[model samples]
Target: MQNFLNLCNAVIGEDYVLHEPAKQAPYLQDWRQRATGQCLAVLRPANTEQVAQLVKLCAEYQVPIVPQGGNTGLVLGSIPDQSGTAVVMSLQRLNKIREIDTANSTITVDAGCLLEAIQIAAEQADFLFPLSLASEGSCTIGGNLSTNAGGTAVLRYGNTRELCLGLEVVTADGDIWHGLRGLRKDNSGYDLRDLLIGAEGTLGIITGAVLKLYPKPISQGTAFIAINSIVQAVALLHLAKQQCHANLTGFELINQLSLELVHQHFPQYQRIFQQARRFYVLLELSTYDNEQVTKQLLEHLITTAIEHGLVEDAVVANSIAQAKNCWALRESISAAQAKEGKNIKHDISIPISQIPNFVQDTDAALQLAFPASRMVTFGHLGDGNLHYNVSPPCGTDQDSFLEHHAEINRIVHDKTDQFGGSISAEHGIGTLKKQELLRYKSPVEIKLMRAIKQALDPHNIMNPGKIL
Candidate 1:
């Protein structure tokens, strides 16, 4: 152990190697406080070369490594194990925008670049990087790629995996695979770039990536609509798609409970409507065309939906500030839930058509089991992903409520299975959902995943005990 520490210190400078408990504690624990771990040391590597060397040394010494980004992951995937044999690798210093090819409509960036930073960079170049989330200011692109994160824009831009065209990775044996090509059409061998994007760093460490960009929208339309039920919301979604066509960029669903939580926590964010309905949708559309046409089209879509009884009432943002204010309501859900109490969150997805059935059945089953629980449902309705979360009764002990996590998960995940939905939609299978992945994935699928893991990280040193 002493020899291993000396090697790491020598390679990454003594200052970059952390040993004190207080200094390393932040890296070993997750942001949500649901997981805490112990590590022998936390190593900050500045670039891909340093990462390759550190991984090589760790591979030779048989020490495990956990690649962490901003430590903002909902799952405990980035946290180290309690054995203290693992080295936590932080990619914070590798923050750089390598290239921006406007002709190719792509930008190459380092793994540690913040998501919002990338968005700003693209905007500076007069392009758009549509991958966004509530944690855009904190979450790094490396974590986003590793988890294949999805946000409101996924309905139009797709997940991180679909946005990425190439990747640079450090294999478990210390080899750097430079696959960062900006080409859109490359019929190569097996798609290794796709493999590393959503593998949760269990297969290899992602160092950099080439991501797709789009033309900045010249006109934007945002609206908040009163929703009656999930079925009605889905119908409104279909109607909006037909009206807006490819210009529709976002379609989000929010429940009354979620909105109430936001109202309780963030009073300054005035409600979009005077009277809140049972559900709501924060929808958006954009186009490169003139603003007048976009505004007229938005108004027409809302009018048609309201006339059909699909929407009870609606409020369209008349100004940029109003649109931003409307967005704050959707972005504040997670923070509001945290302030409320202990929550059992399920980031699951199913066929877009079955969402209504899934929600009705799951809510009924959960209500029968725990009548006191509150279900806060909201997500990207266009892509069929819902962050269906349950908060314990107002006064239930946090620990006692957490004890029912497994049972609560069973009830929700079982319903998800009945609807043929995935257990994890965007959040990867970190320590939090390992067993769930096993139960949901088929034997052949699991075997194939294990085989790939063995082939890339034969020693099981890269993010050991994660994903597969």
Candidate 2:
């Protein structure tokens, strides 16, 4: 172990290698405190060559490696195991913008670049990278690609998988696979870029990528519309999409419970409607037209939606600040829930048509089993992804409530499966969902995944015990 540490120290400098527990704490812990891992050291390599060398050393020693970026994953995927034989490789230093081709509408960036930094670069180039999240300031493109993150803009642009043009990855064998081409149409042999984008670092470490860009929105309008039911919200989404067409960028659903929590935690964030309703849809539209025309179009849509009984009440943001504040109300849901109590989060997705039924049945089942449980449901309605989370009954012990995580997950996941939905929508099958994935996926599907893992990582050195 000492010799291995010495080799790592030589590859990246002693300053870049953290051996002490105190120094490695930040890299070893997850964002939600759901996981804490112990490792021999946290290695920070500067470039692709250094990363390849470090991976080669780990391969030689048969040591497992966990590729982490910004350490903000909710599923504990980036956190290392407690075996102490693994190395947590932090990719914060490889933060560079390799190139920006406005003509091709692509931006090439190192995997370690923060999402916000990428957004800024795209804006500076008079383009837009639509992948966004509340944690963009700290989350890296590598983690985003590894998990195939989806955010508000997924309705218009797409998920991380769709936004990516190419990827520069370091495979388990310590060899660099340079597939970073900005071309949009390349139906070559195998699509390796898609394979690594959402592999969660099991097959390889993503060092860089080529991401697609879009024209910046010249005019935008945001609104918070109160709805009477989840079914109404879904219907509202359909109507809104039809009315706004391609300019419809965001369509989010927030339940009354979620809004109450946000109001409780972040009092400064202005409330959406004057009176609370059963559900709210935080919708946005952007186009190349002027703000007045966009705002008027949004107003007309909201008026029509209200007349159709899809919306009970609506408040359109008059300015950019108000729009951001409306988004703040949506983005603050998770944090507010954290402040309220321990929650069992389910990033599940169902067919848009079946969302209303899934929510109704699941909520009823959970309540019938545990009469006191509370559900906070909200997410990107346009993409059919909902963060269906459970909070323990009021005044219950948080730890004791957490003990029912398995049971709670079973109920939610079973309902999702019945609806032909995915148990993991965007979070990926990290350590938290391995057992669930096995239970939900068929034997044939699991076998295919295992064969791929074994083929790429024969010794199981890259992020061992992750998806497979």
lDDT (Cα atoms) of all candidates against the true structure: 0.92, 0.93
**Weakest 10 consecutive residues of candidate 1 by summed lDDT:** 393-402
Model 1, residue 398: distance off in Å is 3.0
Clashing pairs in 2: none
Candidate 1 lDDT, 357-376, residue by residue in tens: 99999888888988888899
Can you tell me which runs of candidate 1 are displaced by over 4 Å? none
Each candidate's number of clashing pairs is 0, 0
lDDT by residue (183-298, candidate 2, tens digit) is: 88999788889988899999999999999999999999999888889889888888888889999999999999999999999999987776878889999998999999999999
